[model samples]
Target: MTAGEPDLVGPEILDGHLYDYPAYYDLVFGSDCAAETAFFEDCFRQLARRPVERIFEPACGTGRLLYRLSRRGYSVSGNDLNPHAVAYCNARFERAGWDPPAVLGDMADFRLRRKVDAAFNTINSFRHLDNENAARSHLGCVAAALARGGLYLLGLHLTPTRGPRDMGESWTARRGHLGIVSNLQSISIDRRRRVEKFAMSFDVYTPTRHRRIEGILEYRTYTLEQIRRSVESVPSLEWIETFDFAYDISRPVVVGNLTEDVVLVLRKR
Candidate 1:
């Protein structure tokens, strides 16, 4: 009913990797698919040096956004490390009578058959690189896959310049007979190592069963300076603009010490 409000319905608790449950994961994150697609299209129109058509996504869990973009006639392709998610995405495309585009691959090192007009990886997925070399390598791969002047919209949370702190968020979403109450919290922060650990739990409600799925994950932390350096490490990509999670193209924000959620628009040189 409200943010972080506990559900009244009791659920059977279980520990599991969230990515393994593609259907439930989609329900939690796919609710805003349309809006996010619109924002990406606007970004391409407003910032890309060439007309945007072909698109790519690294770590495209469940292929929700890719499917949405494909329906809008944009050539969309994506890769993910999860076999379940890749299978789920392909099945979804087949059920829709469209050609499947999702493939199994890693985010830090992968290539495309052809260069795309734009690429994106959002919602702090980039932070999973876990180190400077991996982060820079991923950027290099994206740059190599993009046509000259193509845009790569990378979204993630930046560590506060003052210091790291424990924080959390929660939300609820429902689709037909299924509902999801999701909670995500930062369990640990190592400023020296530039890493943060998170615990994510989802209370899933269905007609036949109710279960709580929990997962622990680690993400590499980046300050404003650190991210700037990472971008600079990739010679082909230039950091063009910065926006918050609001996905507003008109309102570019200067990333600073206090900035948390950041969406960086990188252009391939």
Candidate 2:
């Protein structure tokens, strides 16, 4: 069976934790791995002051990007708060006959034995640090883990100043005999508290088995000004440029009140 393909068994419904199933998570999110990896390399080439030979990823679920980067000849390491993700990543590395560096660690406060050339945490994972203190600490930690002049690519969606506050999206992906249909919707949006509660559900189908998984998650919402202030709190890192989800290094954008998706390029001072 391929990765993420469930065994040929009976039908079942599970109220499962989303992050606990790394393979299925990869199936949903890993399709753009090559594009994202290329984007990272381009960012390093265009924006980084130092050669990005060794890179790190925080909140690297399943090491999907890490594995791809390693294959591309860059030294890669990452950490995740989920033990299952850590184990899954390490297992993949071991299968490839490479040393595994994914470890169970918190993104807000974790240390690396050696500094890296560049690091990244994308796709709004940084918003998981639900408080100002934790967000500041995560920035400080990433700054400390980089050499001088190193770059950190942080990507997230900013809270919109206008329009509908509630939002959602759905995705469908298939690998081999496994098919997954996933939906993510905001159940609650509290502007005053800077929080958004999300309801996520996945319907999986195999040849002989069908499973439905559900999970709820929360992310801290940040306006453009709020994120700017948070970045300013860490003096060692300077925000250099802002890009949108397109991941195009050639086009840097000015984040205005209307902008939502943003990728901030920070350089260690």
Which tens-of-lDDT digit does each residue in 19-76 have in candidate 1? 8889988989987787789899999988999999999999999999999999999999
Candidate 1: TM-score? 0.94
Off by over 4 Å in 1: 1-10, 163-166
Per-residue lDDT of 97-118 in model 2, one digit per residue for the tens? 9999798889999988999999
Q: Give the lowest summed-lDDT range of ten residues in model 2.
A: 1-10
Instruction: Give, for candidate 1, the lowest lDDT window spanning 10 residues.
Output: 1-10
lDDT (CA) per prediction: 0.89, 0.88
Q: Global lDDT for candidate 1?
A: 0.89
Q: How many clashes show up per model?
A: 0, 0
